[model samples]
Target: MSPEPYLGDTTRTPIRHHILSVLVENKPGVLARIAGLFARRGFNIYSLAVAPAESHARFSRVTIVVDAESAPLEQIVGQLDKLVNVVAITDLAPRDALERELLIASVPVDDDNRLTVLDTITHGGASIVDVGATSVTVMLAGTPDACDELERSLEKFSDVELHRTGRVALPRLG
Candidate 1:
């Protein structure tokens, strides 16, 4: 018998291509249970973000990115909906959606590289959100690959940090 395919990508290409949005009641243990389920199921959640909702709803919007084919992804989606606290499950990547982005990076800079660093920021649609004598943290919002591009462009200057909010789309009408 052959071993099962690994998570994320079977070969080099990521198999599960999905961005799942889960609405859940904000309370202790709820998040853990949900996460535990994924862990046990061997889902490679590449990215996830959770925060409370507005209107005192005490709900959290969890964006999950996973790699698998359609049929497998459907099973995962169905199982996710069965969880007790899950309120809604939306495939935001297929549909359109809105997302919030937060970034925190610590970058080292010296006189020799400061200009280069500044140039990278300008090109990345980001600015220095925080500054210190030897380091700076640049912040930006957009696609994950955009942020990766910025990091790649600046790789020569010094060490860098990157965080991606992943790709999110909302219906054009909205």
Candidate 2:
């Protein structure tokens, strides 16, 4: 086994809460390069979200979370921009960003149920994405602060599982 490489000085205290926004051409291995960059730099990413940015062409918007000093983060983005497919890369975590979060909870079903399915729909912006005899998938998207409140409401039901995606944010363009 081999130890991972460090992107910056291996001795510095950790710097928390850094976000990277990437615009890359949607291709077969584009994602690999982006992920590789972080790994090569010895950066530990906290959250990653990638989705299609353009419908016409194969383009994607990737958001990655890391803890690094200013110079390292800047260099990471700078190097990425130098690539042929990298359209743009910005560290949006410390910038003027708009953030959102999503939580999907699954609840089990039983013979005697006090709170019916409809009861769950009306609370906490919960929307039924799927429903079966055994479980139900309810999705809620909003600020992280409110996610806790929603979670509490779901506790009353037969919640069996929870899935959380990392917080996502983009600069608030004026």
Candidate 3:
């Protein structure tokens, strides 16, 4: 289904999370302007990811996940559209998009439980990216649910550090 346009009345819609994919000029200050707009309007951003778009040097795509309950989605999109550097904006429906996040975690591994730790990583479909004397860094790139499962499994071990990329998504092709 196509997304409702920002010009329409959207306040009647139930409050929930929304993901906005915005394409903007790849120049300094664009990110700040978009972020400032949200901040000035008191919109709470859940997660944001930005990168150059499809190898293009002049454009970048920003994926922003926000709680629509904080503010009307139309208002937020309208304000974003008004920005000078913003080229386009698309609201990505969760069901119609492919979303993924990258997780990196450091788990302590020793002679006693080294095999167990590797087993956990293997079962979770993650890869051991680095190996240290006492710790191994594992990397997992998968859906949020998969990442959560991996995190829970890793908790069984001694966790030294963990980090995850917020999220990035694209609409699925027919």
Candidate 4:
């Protein structure tokens, strides 16, 4: 099966990142099947995030970011649609979507640099979630760029541990 071309300027050769919002059955192994398809097709996934969808346990949402130049977008979408558990797929345009990622960082903060660390976090619009005598854990939910900026600033601190959730997005509605 072949998917219809939904992306404009299919002839363009520049590498562009695309976000695919997939709705699938929440049953086991659904994620693996989708991921397997990408692997078999030699498509590289830049980031992927999966979570429950709506208020029901019967569906899950998988948000995947891929480089369009790495594989034919139509072919990828077609293969994904063939999966038995897949319900829907939406290709979100970066400018027309609301996207966010969550980042958590644990930084060593002694008396000397505690204020500096806190100030950096505050400047990044992040909040301290946990504070210990020697370290502080902060959480930030924002765009990928914002998270990257925060990560770079936090790197100056000692013993910093950081983790980020992949991008997740929903199309904007009028």
On TM-score, the leading prediction is 4
* Candidate 1 lDDT for residue 108: 91
Write the residue-wise lDDT of candidate 2 on 1-174 in tens digits.
Answer: 112111222112124557778888988899888778667776667778888886846778888766665347767767677768888777765445665667788878666662665575445656778888777777777655455556776777755587778667777779
All models: lDDT?
0.65, 0.67, 0.82, 0.82
Better lDDT candidate (2, 3):
3
- lDDT tens per residue, model 4, 4-84: 212223123223778899999999899899989999999889899999998989999999988877888888888889999
* TM-score versus the correct structure, for each prediction: 0.78, 0.68, 0.85, 0.88
Global lDDT for candidate 3?
0.82
Q: Root-mean-square deviation of each candidate, in angstroms?
A: 9.5, 10.5, 8.1, 8.4
Candidate 2 C-alpha error for residue 69, in Å:
6.1
Give the candidate number with the greatest lDDT.
4
Flag the better candidate by TM-score, 2 or 3. Answer: 3
Backbone clashes in model 3, listed as residue pairs: none
Superposed model 4: Cα runs more than 4 Å off: 1-15
**Per-residue accuracy of model 1 over 89-124 as CA lDDT, tens digit each:** 878553243433444467798888788778777776
